[model samples]
Target: MRELFGEVIHTYTRAQALADGSLIDVTETAAEAGFRLPVAVTRTVWLRYCEWPEELGTGQSTEGRLWDVLWLAVWAARTAAEPSARITYTLGVVPVDDPEGDPVDVRLWAAITGEGAGGAPVVTIGAPEDW
Candidate 1:
C-alpha cells in the first residue's frame, strides 16, 4: 500500500479553473497513471467514505450517482477558486495482499482543504471494496 498526493487539480475541472484564472494549463497532460476505476465502483467507495445527502440518496437509491457527485465537486472547486483557495486531493492505493491472485488496485481520494460543513467534500472519487 502506498499513498500519493497530487498538486494538480483534476483535469475535469481544468477549463473552469483556467477561466477563473485560479489555474493555468500550459499544456495537456496524460491521465493519471493507474487503473481506470469504474464509476459504479467509485460510487460505492465514496459512499463508504462519507454520509450521503437526503437528496443524493444512498447506494441502493436511484438518485445521485458517483458521476453526479464528481461533477458537483469539480464545480464547487471551480466556483470556489480564489486567491486563497488551497483545496487539494490525495489518492491512496492499496494493493491486494494475495500471493496467488493478481494484484488489484484499490484507490481512494479525499479533498483536503476546501471541504465545508459536511465531512465529505462536494464530491469525491474512490474504489469499491470488491473492485
Candidate 2:
C-alpha cells in the first residue's frame, strides 16, 4: 500500500496522540473494570463524561465516572454476539453542574485496534461522532 501510495508524507500515531493529550490513557482504570487490553478515551469524552472538576462541588468522582464507562464497555463486549472491530454502548451520566437532574443518555463507541497486525489489541472509547 505504501508503495502504491508513494512515499509517506506524514503520520500521527496513537502514542503521539496519548503524549499530546489528544487521547487520555485509562488502561489502569479499565483494568480494574475487568479489561485486560490497553484502553483510552478521546479528549472530548474525557471532558464531557469522565472529568469531574472540583469547582463543581459534586459528589461524583472522576474515577467513578471513568469506571462506569469502562465497566459498561466490558459488559457490552462480553455480551456481543461476535467479536468485531467496534462496539457501541450507551450509558447514563448525571451532569456535573446538575447532579440532581435526570441522567442523560450518551452513546459511546469502543474500537479495537492492532488485532491481526501483530500488536496487542487496544480499546479506544469515544463519543459516537468521534468514530
Candidate 3:
C-alpha cells in the first residue's frame, strides 16, 4: 500500500514539473533526437523518443526518460491508441477546499489497464477544508 501511495505522489510531481518546464526538458531533448513535432501538452503532454543510427547515436535506445515516457502514455490515453494505450495522469477527486494552501486536489496518473486499475497523483494546491 505504501508503495502504491509513493507512486501516486511521483506522478503528481512529474505532471506539474512537465507542465511547468521545470522537469527534464522534453521539448529540447526530443528535438535533439530529431523529432519533428518535438514535445507538446494538450490537456496532457506528448513526446516520442528515438535513438537511431542517424540521431543521437547508433543502436542506442532512447528510452527510460521518465517525463518522456509519461508524455507518450498521456498521448496514448486515447481509445484508438489502446493497442499500446495507457493512463499516465488525471485530475482525481478535486475536493473543494477553501482555496487555501492545504486543500485536497487529487490528480491521478498511472498505466491503467481497466476500471479501478488506476493510480492517484493528488496535486493538492489549496487548504484542506473538508476536515
Candidate 4:
C-alpha cells in the first residue's frame, strides 16, 4: 500500500494549504483539462476522513487528525450527449500545522464522484489493512 500511496503522502505534507475550491461552470473547459467531467453535476457532497494510530501509546485519534482541502476549481459539465452523464475528482489532501505545531499526517482522502447506483454519493475512508 505504501508503494502505491507513499509519494502522494510525502508530497501532501509539503503542499500549500488553504485553497479556494469554488464551483466552476466547466462545460467549455473539461476537454481542455483532460477532464471528462459531466456537463451538469446534480449534487455535491462534503466528507471528512480520520485515522488514529493504533500503537499502544498512540493517543488522540479524534484530536490528532490533521488535514487540508486543496484549491480545486472543479466542475462537471454534460458529456456532450448523455444526460445521465457524470464526473469525478481525485480531491487531494494537504497537511497543516495543527495546534500542537506538528505537521498533519494524512491517512486518507476526500473523494468525489457522481451519485452511486444507490442514488447517493459515497464518502469516508478506512486505511488499507496492508498499510
Candidate 5:
C-alpha cells in the first residue's frame, strides 16, 4: 500500500494480482491501511461500488440483489479460515462500457487466511471484470 495525499492506495501490481487470482492474502496490506476485518473492507468496497452505473434487473431490484451479495460476502468472510476459505460472488448483470449494449456480469473473488503475523486475519478482494 502506498500513502498518497493521506490516502492509502493499492499498487497496480497488487490490484491486478488480486483480480487475476495470484496474490490471495491481504492481511499485512490491509493492516497497513488500517483495516482489520474482511467484512469492514468488503463493505467499504460495496459502498463505493454502489456509486457506479445502475444495473437494472429483469424481475428484481438491483440494489436488493447487491445487498444480498454484500450480506453473503460478509457472512463468508466471518467464517474465513486459513488455507481454504474463499469468498466468491457475482454481481449479476451490470452496465458496461456501452450502456446501449448488453450489460455484463461482474464477479468478485476473495480469500482469507491466518498467515499474517500474530495470526491476524488476511483478506483479499478482486473482480473478474470492471464494475
Candidate 6:
C-alpha cells in the first residue's frame, strides 16, 4: 500500500504494457476459442508459439497456432480441480525452422490479473519465468 511504501515514484501499468507491445491482446481470438474473459500473451510466448514467419516455408498459420494455444489453455482451466488464479500447462510447438523435427514441449502459465481492462479480471498467458 502507499502507506507502507511511502509516496509512489513510478508505476508501469497493464495499459502501458499493451500499448508498448510488451503484451499482445488476443481477446478476440480467445473469445472465438471459447474464452469469456479478456486474454493476452507475453511477447515471448507469442514469438515462440504463435508467430509463423513466412521464410520458414512451413504450413503453420498464426491463427491456427494461436487457436491451439488458447484451446489448450481453456482445457487446462476447465479441468482444474480447484479454482485458482493461475494455471500452468505444457504445449508442444514445432520449431519454425525445423517443422519436421520433434515437437518441443513448452511450459506456459495463464494467470488472472486483479485489475485489467474496464477493471475486470483478464487472463495473461506467458512463460513460467515471465510470471
Q: Return the TM-score for each candidate structure.
A: 0.23, 0.88, 0.20, 0.21, 0.37, 0.92
lDDT for 128 (candidate 3):
20
Give the worst 10-residue stretch by lDDT in candidate 6: 52-61
Q: How many clashes in each structure?
A: 0, 0, 8, 5, 0, 0
Q: For all the candidates, what are their Cα RMSDs to the real structure?
A: 16.5, 2.4, 18.4, 16.9, 11.1, 1.4
What is the Cα-based lDDT of residue 26 in candidate 1?
Answer: 19
Highest lDDT among the candidates is held by which one?
A: 6
Which residue pairs collide, candidate 1?
Answer: none
Error of 3 at 120 (Å): 22
Per-candidate local distance difference test: 0.33, 0.87, 0.33, 0.28, 0.48, 0.88
Model 6 over residues 89-116: C-alpha lDDT tens digits?
Answer: 9898987767778789989999988658
Candidate 4's residue-wise lDDT over 1-131, tens digit each?
77876644443110121123222123333334343432211112122322233442334342233221111222322232333222232333322223234343333222334323344443222222211
Over all chains combined, what TM-score does candidate 1 have?
0.23
lDDT of 5 at 72: 51
lDDT of 3 by residue, 12-79 (tens): 34456545743333445544543333343222212222212223332233353333344433443443
In order of TM-score, best first, we have: 6, 2, 5, 1, 4, 3
Clash count in backbone of candidate 1: 0
lDDT at position 79, candidate 1: 58
lDDT of 5 by residue, 47-78 (tens): 33332444632444435444544555565555
| C-alpha RMSD in Å of predicted model 3 compared with the true structure | 18.4
**lDDT over C-alpha atoms for residue 116 of model 6:** 89
Worst 10 residues of 2 by lDDT: 114-123
Query: How much is the lDDT of residue 114 in candidate 4?
Result: 37
Identify the candidate with maximal TM-score.
6
